[model samples]
Target: MPVPSQRYVRNHLLSILSPDDYEAIQSVAEGVALGRRDILIAANKSITHVYFLESGIGSEVAATPEGRRIEVCITGPEGIVGVPLLLDVDRTPHETFVQIEGDAVRVEATAFRRLIEERRLLRGIFAHYAYVAHLQTAGTALSNGSHTLEERLARWLLMCHDRVDGDEFPVTHEFLSTMLGVRRPGVTTAIHSLEGAGMIKARRSHVQVLDRDKLKAAAGDSYGVPETEYRRLLWARR
Candidate 1:
């Protein structure tokens, strides 16, 4: 485990922090490789650390005892994994896990809490970012309640596209089904619909964005609001 250097940073929130703020984080951070399905925060358990992704995507999933779960929030390289900890929470019913394999620099929960306590400005910055994260989750809830399957899928893919380094990403029907809280067959149908409209191209286990505007159109108003808020709240000054 090498120390995470501030020289290389892709997590947008971390990138925006002042030099001293970032240096404080580096003092407590260590680079880690994350694999798909790696649990960062288990439901009902005390959080051990907070992960700031340098690449790939993570998910905060809501689950029921009946064995149903849905991704309520998506954490890309632009976000952090342990958001509830910022609100002084140590545990939550929602589980946070890696949705795609990638790299991250994580800080132990105690050290990070101490850092925030000592640095008021950094805490303010994180609070604004936390609000942006909240907006994304709210957007997911709104889409799940009011959008069609195609619209929802389009929005999800667009979000993924934004996070990935390129237009193409590895995904499967089973994975998409789990994320969207839909059946495998329904995800297939939605993929075909997006392909038919020329917004995306899908093969056996991957999808590529062909036309971003078209995907946005397919998503209608269900997408972009949270993205807008993210930019306004987090990236406006930077």
Candidate 2:
């Protein structure tokens, strides 16, 4: 597969692919436009494709019998949407929905599986991604169970910023309410709390980080490798 210029431009995993492996898988990939609130994977269903985000964000959400849903993780360009495919797990553990409109590279599961079997470098990167995803899942569970809403919000913002590589992005309060599993008013309060603390400035659809260090402290022990792995893997000088 010849590497697409757009793919080689920004994808973390694609950047790490060995020359031949990158070329091998690149041809099978196709780009697609994703809109807000798109359901990429339904809960308990089989995930037949993996999405490599080029410029948007997706959330892994878990829903209960009472219709309560909470976001477990955020995936953007730094990661893929269909996590189970990497581990060869057919059924999805949770629902994946597009949170923002963006572009992504789609690879069918069958083709991706074949690529994984034949490419050692791709296999290793996905393995590391799986471990990091596991760590994120565990950390999110702990954060929800033990942390306050404000703490969780701070942690969520930091994670988003890390993945998007920016402090500001388009995100509405409604989405935050759903992601945090709280009411709109609760999200308002949390934003106000962070603003009052001089940690962030929340506008209509953007929350600017004014004091990242302070926000980091508010997040406490909730931050994990999913937020830091890029630096450790791609930016570190060997």
**Collision pairs in model 1:** none
Q: Residues 1-238, candidate 1, lDDT per residue (tens digit)?
A: 5645556687888888898999999888998999999999999999999998999999899998997989999888888889888999999999988888899989999999999989999999888878988988899999999999999999999999999998999999998899899999999999999999999999988899999999999999989987898888887857
Output the worst ten-in-a-row residue range by lDDT, candidate 1: 1-10
Position 152, candidate 2: lDDT: 93
Q: Give the candidate number with the greatest lDDT.
A: 1
Q: In candidate 2, residue 180 scores what lDDT?
A: 86
Query: Per-residue CA lDDT of candidate 2, range 24-99, in tens?
Result: 7678887788898898888888787888887778899998888888988788877777878777888775899888
Q: What lDDT does model 2 reach? A: 0.81
Error of 2 at 109 (Å): 1.0
TM-score of each: 0.97, 0.90
Model 2: how far is 185 from its true place, Å?
2.4
**Alpha-carbon error at 196 in model 1, in Å?**
0.9
